[model samples]
Target: MAISASVSLVMTLAFLLASCGGMGTHRGTPLELTIAHINDHHSHLEALPDQIVRIGGVDTQVELGGFTRLASAFRSYEGRDNVLRLHAGDASTGTLYYTLFKGRADADMMNTICFDAMAVGNHEFDDGDAQLKSFIEQLHTGPCKTPVLSANVHPQRGTPLAPQNAEDYIQPYAIKNIRGIPVGIIGITIKRKTQDSSSPLPSTSFEDETSAAQRTIDQLKARGIRHIVLLTHQGYQADKAMATKLSDVDVIIGGDSHTLLGNFSKQRHLPKSAGPYPTRVANRDGKPVCVGQAWEFSKAMGEMNVSFNAEGDVTSCTGQASLIIGDRFKRKDAAGKWVAVDPATPQKIAAEAATDASLKMLAEDAIASNVLRSYSSQTEKMQKESIGEASQALCLVRTPGESFNASGEVAGCEEANQRAHGSDVTQLVAQSFLRTSLRADLALHNAGGVRIPVPAGAITLGQAFALMPFNNVLIELPVTGEQIIAVLEDAVSSYLDAGRSSGGGHPYAAGLRWHLDMSQPKGRRFSRLETKDRQSGTWASLDPARTYIVATHEFLARGQGGYASFKPIYDSGNYVNTHFLYTQAFVDYVRAHGKVQRPAPADYSHQAVTTQAGVVLH
Candidate 1:
């Protein structure tokens, strides 16, 4: 009986690792490797609408980072030898590009640059194993094949990723014969976070990332592969720790935290960098090990130059991560349509009035031309298709609350209008749910769930989806009025204790109103709680003991992101999905009420402070 091909592939790699004891023959040459990497791209195929950059000390709007600039960066390294391009993880989710086309649009773009090797991101499992398997196949449809890797992943028996199809795509490590010297690239992904956050099946399992890296590094070294690079999605801080944990790993190219590295002080107006490029950490043996992360959303590309001694130990590491941006392109308004750059600005890259014309000229190469263009052409048309209209701009505002301080006394709010009020976006989404679900007494939604503002204009399907990108379903659950109050308290109290950045965990809701007093104790801040009277459309005090059916998204119902108060409700099995996509519900609700108008400006909450001492959020 002959052994299977899958068996052979697995056994051969294992045998190569298992049987080897000593260093193999060739000492060859002092190797130089240039690795270009990006992670958490989130299917941002083009320059994102919200990317802001400072030009000539002027807060200028420009196209900053897209596939075009990344393509140019890769092309710049053409004549260099032993060069490899890597994407750490998360090549999915976030935009209409992924929503309409799914991973196909992302796969088409990946094939454009054809990364040498990529780690499996948690978002890759958003559609489950079958989709990830399909994406792997699609990614290889190019002149050269790009290997996908994830060393910590172990799919249980009877799963799609079980031995049957797994061997064809995912690999533990890839050995590249660079400059006659073997360089091993190992992949590691976030373990528990992947299981908790995404849609991976129950049978699939993840090992500890540090432990997995050590095992893989040992195997690679056993086979006499010297220069090992750990390509990971475990985030920046963990990458720093892994340097001390893994002895043989010379460099860690990382992702998942979306951490920006390198100096950005020169580039004012950009978000501050997390640390220096290739943030150096000492290994267990006290040897220098370098780590780098390109900022997320393909806004930047990581460039690292590493030199190794003849013995395979790294001698020196250098190079900085750079932002990818364009000098010329159209700008977008808050509502996210392609609009011309401001005419009043002193400097304009292109003098012509930006028209509703082809942006296909931005496509600089074959990948953008043959692949991205086709998808762009269709989606662009769909983006312009009118869904409905809004009467006025529903601005996404974030204002620090009066009493919310790092010391945990004040319960601050993230957003406000003329009054220290809550966000309109959150309130609008909550209201839409109530309109669609008639039985609900209250509607609640997270402020972050709505990514963008709804500009007062013709709303398009593109804009609607952008505002709500998560695939959360509308869900309704039964809870006492007391529980609802506790939820609101928990939303603010937890963030205040942690001094959370963007700590605006304050929830917004419709069919309800409440007053928040910063001077009061944490749990006692909310007062004058009221619910809408369905009969008269007037406010009525909420009775603490009375039960009410509340509408919220599946994300909230699942008790995720500091919503553990809802976990008991989730465990009660009383909650049920309304079988409507939350984002689509907004569209349906808006269409049902022709010409959607901003809800009347009314204070949902009030804030007051007694202390004269200045409070600043840590």
Candidate 2:
């Protein structure tokens, strides 16, 4: 193992502390722990192939991530003492695997690692509590019996989650005895975001995150557990702030927001990381709290090692996240087609890649590979059946003019967001909803609902499923023009003003157009509001008093993701659910319409945009 200078310093301190026999009792029985963790795998059990990564300052295509490689990494520490394996959260949704098997496949793959404990992410309830229950049951069926936890969730007595007993399904925390010392791992899920954006039963409720975490910490303290680790599904920024608000939380392994926390300066293929790995924050008691999160989609794993004093205060913390990869390499030919490199290049690339601390080259684990093979055989056939074709790739952008997806991954559509319009893929989804609902005059959709960009060529059944993987249904509501403007403002403020820049609340709509100015306050960002005439194909100014039927997914219509105006209209008995699956509606739209193409400029929802800095995007 190549030990960096910092690692050497940490090791020296560990040795001296060990020699001092508990550091003279100010530290108590000093404990040193190793944690291997991953988060937001999101059902991506198979490795992503043909990904371009920079090795030795050269662009080389290779396979990256997957449960197989993650399993291999975890198994490497099998005989090591005081080592803990954990998965932060978000083990389901976002791919064909979840679409077809509904988290069963995810559970099988997750059991490969046999995590000590897994936090309950919001997407676990996408199919409702019953489905979550089934997935949890499968997770426990294996030998691991990993605890599924959420401290803030409160299930109703008769609900599927708590029908018999809440403890039977979910736990508030797990106690892991490492080397004769009991360590408390408390789980905290995002309270508001889960209740708003997911499909939890209305009868079930959630407690505030801070209060729940504090209360749980008190309970765990009463049990005499000194070392505390908060395994949270809260965003990275939120977790850092949470540390300052609480005491005795020595470490946090978090998910949600899919944050990449590491020094990726040498990894050119990856985006700019959020921060340094094992980000250190000060807790309420002024003690150091180590916080870390792995990037999403099974791409990377975070390994953190922490040493505590006898008093359970974090004395030292060190570690880094490694991007998992294989040795196979590819490069684009002169004709712009991807072709495998010469056989000799693989070893050379691997030798050079080994120098970078963040890159790990490991072959897939045999047991995990076999488990994934059983489920992938069915998805392969489903992926092959073509549902539609696209003449040009559709760009996936959440906020207009933001830098995400601007990489070469989208091909010719790299500059798509440089224009005023936001997401081409989400706009197409909204259009599909509008076309399917004859009674609706407009369709609205959240940018986060659409997963990936569409490549030009034959679109398969699996591609459609992957693009719209949530278990959402189409709904229609008669909302006034004023309500439409209010919702748009709400969506914009949710991300811009409220700091959810991770892109869940930004709105994209069909049959509606507006000029957006972020410099304006709430309810004033949208101007020049217009609605298209279904009959004449002409745009007309919207009237605040006129009621228009709008089509959208059930998630948004339920007032989730900043669409608060729609909830009242839905509760007033003025809404109708088409019950048609949103993904199926997209497939039907493709069949009815010949081929997919980028929407015409006039049909775009964002006619213009002005940034908070007063810069305009035309």
Clash count list over all predictions: 4, 3
- Which candidate has the highest TM-score of all? 2
Off by over 4 Å in 1: 1-23, 26-29, 49-52, 55-60, 163-168, 327-363, 388-424, 446-448, 453-458, 481-544, 558-573, 589-618
Range of the 10 consecutive residues with the lowest summed lDDT in candidate 2: 18-27
lDDT string, candidate 1, 1-618, tens digits: 256888989888677655653236445468888888999888888775544454433344556678866776677677766898999999987778888877888888877787889999987887777777778877887765788899988777567766465455678888777666778899998875566456677777888999999999999877778788999987787788778976878999998877878876645555467799878888887877889999877678888899888777788889777766555545556886656666664234332212211011132555565677888888898778787887866655432343211111111222233234545556777889888888888888776577566666788888888778778898899989889888887776655544433434557788777766544556886778888866678878888899988898887787754566887998888887898899988988777777876577542432321211233222
Per-residue CA lDDT of model 2 for 1-618, tens digit only, reads 556988999888787756744322233688999989999998888888888778888778889898899999999999887987888888989899999899899999889888999999988988889999999999988698999988988888778888888677889999887887788898989887787778889887888887888899888776667888999998999999999999778899999988888988876656678889999999999999999999889989999999998777789999999999987889878897789988878888889899988888999999999999999898899888988888888888888876545333656675766668878888999999999999999999998899888888888888898899998899999999988988999888877887665667889999999899888888789999999999999999999999999999988998888888888988887889899999998998887776998899989899998877787887
Residue pairs clashing in model 2 are: 27-310, 27-311, 28-310
- lDDT scores in order: 0.72, 0.87
Total residue pair clashes for candidate 2 = 3
**What TM-score would every model get versus the actual structure?**
0.77, 0.92
